[model samples]
Target: MRKSRAVMGNLLPFIIAIIFIFPIIWMLFVSLKPQGLGISNPLKWFLPPYTFTNYVHIIADFQVLRWLLNSLFVGIVTTIITLIVTSLAAFAISKINFQYKKFIFIFFLIGLMVPGEATLIPLYQIAQSMHILDSYIGLIVPGIASPLGVIVLKSFFDSVPKEVIESARMDGCSLFRIYYSIVLPLAKPALASIAIFTFIGSWNNFLWPYMITFSDHLYTLPVGIPVFNSNYSQDYILPMTVNAVSSIPLIIAFFFFEKQIVKGISFSGIKG
Candidate 1:
């Protein structure tokens, strides 16, 4: 019975993975279908004289490459800024004993519960007031100080031993030196996890970019692909093709960073 239970446990994840992955697999097949072949009929779905024209056309004519670059820029910038800010804030909250530390940490936690939609109007107004609308700054700045990133880093930072920090201080290391040298090196797994999560979040973000950017040049992949899809909806295969192409970066990111993500999340649960 124990052996059987182990086998069942191993099989369960594979089953769940297939269940989740089937839709993406189906979408890829559908995207490969020849133009003018509708997917309305189940039997006809795979009865395809497949072609690469959908992908070819999107790359050749649409702004997919540009949108992809925009997303990459935003994702990279947001991740960098988030890491810097959150690392500092997290170091302060986790390491430094200061007045109102608990209050400040609680304040950041409150930000996690507030929905983005609730702040949309205020954010929009602030963007307009700052005259940064339709610019990359508009897309990048607001996302830098994310509460989730702060919380994650703070948790990881808190797990660092107080003795090690004090030892470094006794050895005449500055706070920034300790943070830069000791704490950050120990927190590599968590940092990698946060970088991947932040980049993915920024890359996949549609709503904020949609609201902030007024020009086509500023549109990220999630925003641009949908508009392109709607414009070319008559060619049913095109939308699916765009979606498949857009998902490639995320797949590549996960393939490379999956180990770090798992390690980080696992290690984060350990008490200091």
Candidate 2:
């Protein structure tokens, strides 16, 4: 019974993974189908008449490359800024003792409960007032306020030995030095997790960029792809092609950072 249970435990995760990944696999196959062929029949999707025609047409006709570069830029910038801000905030919350520290930590926790959609109107007004609309500043700046990263990193930081920090202080290490040298090195897994999550979120973001950006040049992949699709609404292959293209970066990111993701989430859970 124990052996059977163990086998079931191992098997369950694979089953779940397949369930999640199956759609992406289907989308890839559908994207490869000739322009008019895949939409009518689902079963014919995997059949042998595949070509790169859709990819070629989309790349040549649309601003997809520019959109791709825009998404990459925003995602990378957002991830970097979020890591720096959240790590510093997390370090302060975890290591430094001050009045109302618990209150400040709880304030950040409350931010996690607030839905991002709720802030869109205010954010839009603020961006409009600041004249940052239709710019990279609008796309990248708002996303850096990451409560989730602070929460995750704080949990991991809590797991670090207080004695080590004290020793560093005793040895005349400044707070910034301890944070830069000791805390960050120990929090690599947590930071990696936050970085991946931030990048993916920024890359996949459609609504904010769509609302803020007026120009095609400023549009990110999620927003830009749909504009491309609107013109070719009847064609299934083209939509799938853009989706596949948009997904490729994220897929590559996950493939390379899978270990870091798992390790980070595991550490967060255990430490939290």
Find the candidate with the highest lDDT and give its number: 2
Candidate 2 lDDT by residue in tens digits, 1-272:
99999999999999999999999999898788887663456677888888988888767865888998899999999999999999999999999998999899888878767788999999899999999999999999988885878888888899999999999999999999999999999988778888887788899998999999999999999998878888886767888899999998778888999987676567446534
- lDDT for each residue of candidate 1 in 1-272, tens digit (9 for 90 to 100): 99999999999999999999888887788788877774567757666577888778778865887898899999999999888999899999999989999999899878767777899999899899999999999999998856777777788888889999999999999999999999999988788888887788898998999988879988999999878877885766778888988897788777888887666456445421
Error in Å for residue 18 of model 2: 6.2
True-structure lDDT of candidate 2: 0.87
lDDT of 1 at 179: 98
Regions of model 2 farther than 4 Å from truth: 1-22, 36-42, 259-272
Per-model RMSD to reference:
4.0, 4.0
Q: Count the backbone clashes (under 3 Å) in each candidate.
A: 0, 0
Q: TM per model?
A: 0.83, 0.83
